[model samples]
Target: MTTLQGKTALVTGASAGIGLATARMLSHAGARVICCARALERLQIQLDEMPGPGLAVELDVADAVSAASLPDRLPQDWQAVDILVNNAGSDIGGRQPFHEGDINQWAGTIQTNVTGLMQVTAAMLPGMLAREQGHIVNIGSTQGLTPVAGCGAYTAS
Candidate 1:
C-alpha cells in the first residue's frame, strides 16, 4: 500500500467487520477516514479509538434517497474523498433453498448488496472525477465466483 498521508477515505458498512478494519488500516496509513454505517453511535465509538482522524456517519446505504444525498450531506472539508470503499452489504434471510426463500428478503439483499453499492459510488464519483484521482474498492463475496447451494440472492448480487 502506498502512503496516504493527505488522503481522505470513506468506507461504508464501517461499524464492524471488514469495513471497520479497512477504516482503521487507512487511518494508520495516514488518511483521514470517514466511517459510515446505520448505527452512528456504535461506529463513532470505534472511530474514537482509531489511530488517526476519523468521522463517524450514519448511513443506511439501502435507502436510495439517503444514498443520493450523501455527497451533499458530508461536511465541506470531508467532501473530497480520495478513496471509497463500497462494502455495505447483507445476506438477508441467510442461506435457504431458492424456492423456500422469501421474495421480500431477497429484495432486501439485492437492495443492500447491489443497488446500495451503486448508489454510494455514484454519489462519490463526481468528486473523484473533478479531482482526477481516487480509488474505489468494492468488497464482494466468493459466492459470486463459486455457485453456492443455498445463497441464490447473495451470489447473484
Candidate 2:
C-alpha cells in the first residue's frame, strides 16, 4: 500500500457510498482527510470512524457560492490539501425518458455533476498549483462512456 504520511486529502460527497469508502481508505493510508458532503451530521459520523485524523465539512458542491468559499473556510492546518477527490454527483431526474423528464431536475443534475465538479476543482487547484505537489482524482460513471437510455442528464454529465 502506498503511504500518504503527512499528506492531507479532501473528498467531496463523502457522507456515503464511494466517497465515504475513499475517505476511509485515504485515512487508513495515513492521510488526514477532510470529508465533505451536504449532510454535516452524517459526515461527522463517518469522520469519527476513520482510523486516522479527519474533519467533517458541510458542503453542497452544486452551490457555487459554497464551493467557491470552501478553501477559505477550511482550518488553516487543513488548507494545504495534497489530494482532491471530485466525487459528488447527482441524477435528480432518475431513469426517465428525456421528453418526459423534468427540466428542473435535469438542470439540477447538470449543476451538480458537471458544473459542481468544475467548481470544486477550481477551488482546490489554485492551492495545489501553488504548492506544486498534489493530485486530483475524478470519479466518473460508466454512463459517461456508454450512452444509456432514460439517463440523459446523468450520461451527459
Cα lDDT, all candidates: 0.93, 0.94
Best by TM-score: 2
Report backbone clashes per prediction.
0, 0
**What value does the lDDT take at residue 54 in candidate 2?**
97
Off by over 4 Å in 2: none
Worst 10 residues of 1 by lDDT: 1-10
For residues 44-154, could you state the per-residue lDDT of candidate 1 as single tens digits?
799888999999888999999889899889999999999999998899999999889999999999999999999999999998999999999999988899978899999
What is candidate 2's lDDT per residue for 45-69, written digit by digit as tens? 8887899999999999999999999
Off by over 4 Å in 1: none
6, model 2: CA deviation in Å?
0.5
The superposed Cα distance between candidate 1 and the true structure at residue 150, in angstroms, equals 1.3
After TM-score superposition, what is the CA distance of residue 108 in candidate 2 from its true location, in Å? 0.6
Model 2 lDDT, residue 59, Cα: 93
